[model samples]
Target: MNFKNFGSQKYLLSEKMSGFSSLAHCFTTREGGFSTGKIQGLNLGFRVGDTPEDVTKNYRQVCDDMGFSFDNMVLSRQEHTDNIRIVTEEDKGKGLTKESDIFETDGLITNLKNVPLGIFYADCVPVLLYDREKQVIGAIHSGWRGTVMGISAKAVEIFKEKFGSEVKDIVCAIGPCIGPCCFEVQEDVAQHFDSEYVLKKENGRFNIDLWKANVDILASAGVPRENIDIAEECTKCKNQIYYSYRAHGKEHTGRMCAFIELKD
Candidate 1:
């Protein structure tokens, strides 16, 4: 991932997807917007106790900074489920500008140009995908539940079955989340992940490496290891730069997103 600062909106771009001239993708930070309080500065989620007006302005700031039409970006209601939604031009402005009919879906895939598909996060893993050959884009919100459900692999499956995309042509971008350093969990949570992805601390707590787990999932699903890029930044460890649900809980932290659009 390459760090970039455009005015006040600082973000990271996926190196694997950077060479594609038809699209724009970003893993945004918590700086640069009108939001305030617990969900302060560049907050993108309206449901996270942030005012709708401020959230709308924050969205505008990013859309403007990234040269995206605010109405063409589709933001969905994520419930940490493995549900994947196929987005079309009709779904434009659904969650952000218009009233959202989409609910409980944690994944989004689209082929339309100028339509930015986005997934929000604040520690939970955000996996954005692009198939340069097929011009397909996807965004996934893979929290522990979605990770356990294998959402990333499921997305790759959908890319093949629905879009006829070759796995080798697909590039996966794993954004910043809660790294294993501070993703300590109890025995019940640790038991769900594989032994390899979980680390048993001397204190009896377990740390889960979500990045590796998701990368392995994409790899196993047929995407080449070279096509996957991971942002090693941990939202929990670097809460000052990004939002961290683990660092502040649902009631306290703001939200960031992995957003991508197929340009015309």
Candidate 2:
């Protein structure tokens, strides 16, 4: 994944899927928006204690850069579960306009044109799915629990079941997260993973590679390995470029968005 700064908006694109002439998608960074202080730039998570007005303005700035409408954007509440919602026109602006309408899903999928779908993340992996065959797109938030539970794979499964999409035709991107070098976990993480990739540091902490976990989910969902791209940048390791909740540790932190829509 390469971080791209297009003036007021910074985003990440999958290198493997960069040249594919299909779905429009991006994994945003905390570099280009109107919020200040803890929620400094491009903070799209509306209910993270940031002012609603600031979040709205931030969306406006990001949408302006992405060429989408702010009021029409759709978002997920993200419960760290594998639940994925299929959004439609009726769901537009639910999360932003009606702050009370809490969305309880971790992923959103839609084929509707002009309906921008977004998910938020600080240290968690953001996964974007695009089906060139069905012209549908999906965005998912994969925290450690979500990754181990195969939430990314579930999102693709939904796309396949709902849109008749084949896994081979889907291109997936795993964006920047707390990389293995910095994502030290407890024994609970070891209990969750079924792989040999888990490493135990001399300090009695375990490290799990979420990027590999997500890519494995994609592969299990039938997405070809060649079609998947993982951002090599680690959020915790590169705190200056992106926010890291783990590094900040209760310090107010901003969040980035993973967004996509069917281009009209």
Predicted structure with the largest lDDT when compared to the true one: 1
For every candidate structure, what is the RMSD over all alpha carbons to the true structure, in angstroms?
A: 1.0, 1.7
Give the lowest summed-lDDT range of ten residues in model 2. 94-103
What residue runs in model 2 are displaced by over 4 Å at the alpha carbon? 19-22, 99-102
TM agreement with the true structure for every prediction? 0.98, 0.94
Candidate 1 Cα errors over 4 Å, as ranges: none
Per-model CA lDDT versus the true structure: 0.90, 0.81
lDDT of the structure predicted as candidate 1: 0.90
Clashes of 1: 0
Cα displacement (Å) at residue 142, model 1:
0.9
In model 1, what lDDT does residue 6 have? 84
Which residue pairs show collisions in model 2? none
